[model samples]
Target: MNNDTDTARLRKLDQDHHLHPFTNLSRHSQQGGRIISRAEHIYIYDSDGNKMLDGMSGLWCCNLGYSQTLIKDAIYAQLQALPYYNNFFQCANEPAVELARALVEITPAQFSHVFFTNSGSEANDTNIRLVHRYYNLLGKPKKTLIISRKNAYHGSTIAATSLGGMGAMRKQTQGLDYVHHINQPYWFAEGADELPDEYGIRVARELEQKIDELGEDRVAAFIAEPVQGAGGVIVPPQSYWPEIKRICNERDILLIMDEVICGFGRTGNWFGSQSYNLEPDLMTFAKAVTNGYIPLGGVMVGDRVAEVLLSHSGEFAHGMTYSGHPAACAAGIATLSVLRERNIIKSAADDIAPYFQQRLQTLKDHPIVGEVRGIGMLGAVELVRDKHSRERLAPDAAGAVYCRDRANATGLMVRQSGDTMITAPPLICNHSEIDSLVNMLSKTLDQTAEHFNIR
Candidate 1:
């Protein structure tokens, strides 16, 4: 994949047959895409040997970066020992059991058990099943309605897609009727006229309003990410989560925190729930669980839900073939071991993340940068034509799209989500690597400003 001949052959095949997710199929077929051949540390190399800092951490995974030999060796060893196995019909793999226990130990005190799945999408889908069953057992079968927020991205499965509040995705599928949405806590994009704290409280109360509108008895759970990751790192104001916590507690709605992007120290704390100081009945996790080395995701079943689940069980009647595949579990165990031994999460929070946020914060003064918002290593920069009024650089997010292209061409890998440029660099990045990423992004911003005539 590194050489021209192989790259060209691969590109043709990919364009001809590969239908990529979240892409314009016809455009991809016509223009093709970059062939990422290899990676090291926080950088990725294309087929042409163009090295770009992985500012998005390989789609917000790869928290420990590409050089975790521990994870690789674990996967290899697991393959040699177990090769493959299914956790079905009274069968349980050693690695799977060990990983489950390890997860319980690290997560919040409420999380005492886990249900494994191959990806976050599946795990979120499982949330629906578990929530429904929990209520069914409690004899409240009507309490199946779930409330989410607009632009919240749960995952891609039909159930997860409906659970997510992204309109573009929901329109493509016949989503579940049980899931409903309220507005997101994106103050800059939606509530600029109001003070941030005021907007936060107002938006937080929308959850209460939504529950009331739908009848509190019918609404079983309210699901949300601690920070809106795929929705452009929309960091809620300081007042948001506390108010949200109040609503869930008072309304008797089970809180489901989608920590797929914010878990395992992406949010400076071990999990977003801890960072926000909220307790969830269930938590969705994946990606960094294995440091993106293998496919493994699961729900951290908090005691609130687990107790009911355990009290009554007659073959839960829901599971995947690869629910607890041993190799993936080995990868997860090794990843957890690396985090514990090195204390990567805490160190990143105290040092790397602060520096990363500081460097990106400098871009707030740029001519076209409307705002810079982030916590831990994840961040977003909104591109604007008029920073005062918060007018976008171009209609339909063309400016950020152009800026993203410039960044990739100039050796930095960042993402464009609507009018905002978003990044979640690996937690393993040192000061120098963080500097490289920010410097590349800074240059990209200058080019974007010049191109857009934003002076």
Candidate 2:
């Protein structure tokens, strides 16, 4: 089709047929939409030919970045060989096996088995079901509740959402009764004056207290993101993860780390579990598994958990049609190959990420910057009206939107969650690209401060 025809058709089809996820449809209809024609390296080209830097790395995935030929070739080759397969009924594909093996090689040593799904949500949903069922099969049916930290983003599926602590996500839905929440180990908002270890331990104690209140028998597992991603990149205090690990071990409750955002080298380590030193029994992973090229996610179960699962009868009783899709699996293989062969993790975490953070820290001097937090390639600049008091910028004063617009106008594609501008550039970013990213963001910060009339 011609460009004009394609654009018109897409606009019409989108307006009529497409219901975008996590969006207000009615409002979107009025505004039409931004059409991204293509992406190259760290830059996305809109239909209007404007280039924008992808600061959020396309929802915190895209580690290998856009238009990598290796991933394309893998999918093509897989289609030529075996395009699809069913993992059901004792059948599995080569790519699935290879992908699972690849994950095992890189993931924490504790995770020995991998279960596939189509997305992070499904993976987490599977985690909830599998963990709960494992306990039930062990004759502890009363152990059901999955304790999650407040402001954590697990996933959007009912069970996964139930584990998440975002107030907005929990608002309208009738949350699952089996899930419970505890205070996040966010020292910034919760205990600004306290030492990191002290605040972390204090917040970690809440888990024990909640277990007592809910009755230990009722709690089967505790789930969390190593770093709170969607809830504004809230990194925990130093003492938190260690204490959490100890508590879970002492109580015999399985620990589930939702690594959907922080997995696959977004953090300095291969997984957020490693970054935080979390020894989890079950974990959900996606987003970066295939660099978002194809939808693929899975739960990595520890040997103990897997052993318990295998002992039970009747197939574990859950799966999606797209589970272990050959093409997606092929893409995953290629993505991992690129990650390991190129040593992207070390490059991002040890070299590039440190540079990213060093440049990002410059913004902390700005009056609007309350706190700058992140690890490796992922980072966030939090805007505030009063830094000392931790006063948030008024919502929709166009604070975040204004900054995003200014960045895009200057050929940068930064995303904002609340008042924080999040950045997770592709792992392939070079030093020059890194400098450009920081310069563009710095300029946008200046513009935002000027727009708000802040000193």
Best by lDDT: 1
Provide TM-scores for the models: 0.99, 0.96
lDDT string for model 2 (188-273, tens) is: 66788898899999999999999999999889999999988888788888888899888988996898989998899888888889
TM-score of 1: 0.99
> What is candidate 1's lDDT per residue for 1-455, written digit by digit as tens?
56788889989999999999999999999999998889988889998888988999897889999999999999999999998988999999999999999999999889889999999999999999999999999999999999999999999999999999888998899999999999999999999999999999999999999999999889999999999999999999999999999999998789999999999999999898899999999999999999999999999998988899899957699999999899999999999999999999999999999999999999999999999999998999999999888989889999999999999999989999999999999999889988888888988999999998877
Q: What's the lDDT for residue 264 in model 1?
A: 93
Clashes of each: 0, 2
Kindly give the stretch of ten consecutive residues in candidate 1 with the minimal lDDT sum.
Answer: 1-10
User: Stretches of candidate 1 above 4 Å error?
Assistant: none
lDDT of 2: 0.86
- lDDT (CA) for every model shown? 0.93, 0.86
